[model samples]
Target: MRDVAGSWKDLTDDANFMAGTLTGQVRDIAFVTTAVATGDLSKKVMMDMCGELLKLKDSISFARSDRERPLDVEPVGGGGTDAV
Candidate 1:
């Protein structure tokens, strides 16, 4: 039962991470396209986009690592008592 719960938590986390990553990428692309349309495509803008892309890649890597490892859960105390 605990194992199943852990798996569900991991799946939820992964889904959240992926959704966040995709949203960020979409936003970045929109920003870049807007800049280009406005004829403001400077070296700095390109560099900024590259940096954001790298960050997205790092996030994906971190998510993959989390999926590969065992899910970590903390114990909670019972009701109003401090003891578990």
Candidate 2:
């Protein structure tokens, strides 16, 4: 009975630790994405993620880069060089 109690305690401790880590990571991701939504492209999701989380991070990065890209525009009079 003592050994079973110890094992259960160990399992609960590990589960709590994992939950805390996941929560923090999610919070960081939310912070960065919220900043991006507000037009703050300077913010980045710096946390390393795996699987679906990695895909989400990549998507956020792509959104920021897309906004950072310069648009090419032609001169109004057509007599000047194109503007970048």
Candidate 3:
């Protein structure tokens, strides 16, 4: 009976730790998304991640880079629309 109780406590602790970790990750993602929506691309998810979360982080980074790239483009003749 004592061993059973100990096992249950261990399980509970593990669950709590996982919950906290996931919650933090979710909040981080939310903050980054919000910043992006507000036209603030300076924020990036700096957390170390894996699995699906890693993919999400990569996607956000890709989007930020895509947005940043256009700012670097310059027209050929002191700023005039390109003639097709």
Candidate 3 residue-wise lDDT at 39: 100
Off by over 4 Å in 2: 1-6, 79-84
lDDT of 3 by residue, 1-84 (tens): 234557797888788888898888888889999999999999999887889998998999899889988566667866886665
Ranking by TM-score: 2, 3, 1
List the global CA lDDT of all models: 0.57, 0.84, 0.86
Per residue, candidate 1 scores C-alpha lDDT tens digits across 1-84 of 144557798888788887787677667656655654565544122223347676754554454455457867666675456983
lDDT ranking of the models: 3, 2, 1
Choose 2 or 3, whichever is better by TM-score: 2
| Runs in model 3 lying further than 4 Å from the true structure | 1-5, 71-84
What RMSD does model 1 have?
A: 24.7
Candidate 2 on 1-84: residue-level lDDT in tens? 144567798988888888887787799899998998888889998877888888988988898899999998865857685655
RMSD per prediction, one decimal?
Answer: 24.7, 4.5, 4.6
Query: Candidate 3: lDDT over CA atoms?
Result: 0.86
Reference-based lDDT, residue 74, model 2? 63
RMSD of candidate 2 to true structure, Å: 4.5
